[model samples]
Target: MIRTLPLLLAVLASPALAQGLTDLDEVDRQVSAFVGQPTPPVDRRLRLARCTAPLALDWYGNGRQAVQVRCPVPAGWTLYVAMPAAAAAAAAPPLVQRGDSVTIQVGGDGWAVSQPGEALEAGAAGAWIKVRGLVPKAPVLRGRVLRPGLVGVDLP
Candidate 1:
């Protein structure tokens, strides 16, 4: 019985056993609050990991076309929820212009790293645009426009 007890504990402590699938309804509510509008329900087919911490929500793609929902680490996952056409059409005008100096940030879990870069193209909020780090020999990268001069990149 003692041997079996250790085996049972191991199974219970496994990462998969530690987390459950995220609730779609909770995701919908959070997304709606982030966008300041009632967002469409999240697809039921998704099987995202349950977040032990509060999910991080952000704008994604050009013109508020989608919302990026992230379940931070220990259960890291990201899902993009598309907005209705009318909402996309109402997005604000371009905020980041080509050749502008910007901050490129790569974030995950509870940490983020940022560096200065130059925008290679103009973009509105949530738009994915090209940017090159100001550091010598840096490669061009694509990131989502978070604001006038802030771009965010997701970990691969």
Candidate 2:
């Protein structure tokens, strides 16, 4: 028993054994409650870190058809869980149409730049679509539709 106590203590002290992954069941429950319906199970493949703080949930997209689950800093992780198909189908209609003139804006830190561009495909607000600058030989880029005549490009 004395020898076994040391082995037990070492096992308990191990970081891998001490910190557990966040529970997927809890996520499903919270999401289900928010949407007023049963949500499909969160993918186990996500393997999110355990959160010490209370999880925060909010609508992710402009259409409010997806939930953004966040584990506040310390864990500092976020996951986007899409609502059921019926909810998605009820989202707002397309705002930008193919070949429409648009302002493509890319911003970071303290600086932002915008240029005239043309939409390559139609998209609703918050949807990603292909766009190209009006300048000759301008490369096609993909950006999110922010509203009519505006798209925001994310920088890597």
Candidate 3:
């Protein structure tokens, strides 16, 4: 029992605890604006280091719908904020939904090929997702979700 006291003290004195805790509501508000959609409630067990300086929220990674919260201050920390799985699936805007028929346009330099395709994933406007081209043997392509039945692919 005595040996565990040092471990407990170390945890209590950690930088994360010293920085204080962030409010989940504030995190939701910022993430919602970034994603261009209303986010459902965050998990009750989610807690992050308080950011006294400006807080920057960015997408977690490619193909991930989560947000990364970071504090720019020295000795700052980062936290990943992901919406509840069920909420994410239900929150997609009406403009695009999973398995919807959409047009995939692949082009660059003012020229492109537009093909009829199917949306492989549900996404909001301006969100990038997988789309299956109609042509046989065609590979699934990534395109930005535009509107109903519309997806746009940008060529390099």
TM-score of each: 0.47, 0.49, 0.42
lDDT of each: 0.85, 0.84, 0.74
Predict model 3's lDDT versus the native.
Answer: 0.74
* True-structure Cα RMSD, model 1: 14.2
For model 1, residues 1-156, the per-residue Cα lDDT tens digits are: 988999999977865455577878889999888877787898887777778888988888657788999887764999999998666645557789999999999988899999999999888787788999998989999998998899998777
Task: Quote the positional error of residue 33 for candidate 3 in Å.
Answer: 1.6
Candidate 3 per-residue C-alpha lDDT over 16-46 given as tens digits, one digit per residue, 9 for 90 to 100? 5655887777777887887667876667586
Q: In model 2, what are the clashing residue pairs, if there are any?
A: none
Order the numbered candidates by lDDT, best leading: 1, 2, 3
Per residue, candidate 2 scores C-alpha lDDT tens digits across 1-156 of: 999999999977855456677878899999888776776778877777888898898877785668899998763899999877566534457889999999999999999999999999988777789999999999999999998999999987
Q: What lDDT score goes with residue 144 in model 2?
A: 93
Query: Model 3: how far is 86 from its true place, Å?
Result: 9.4
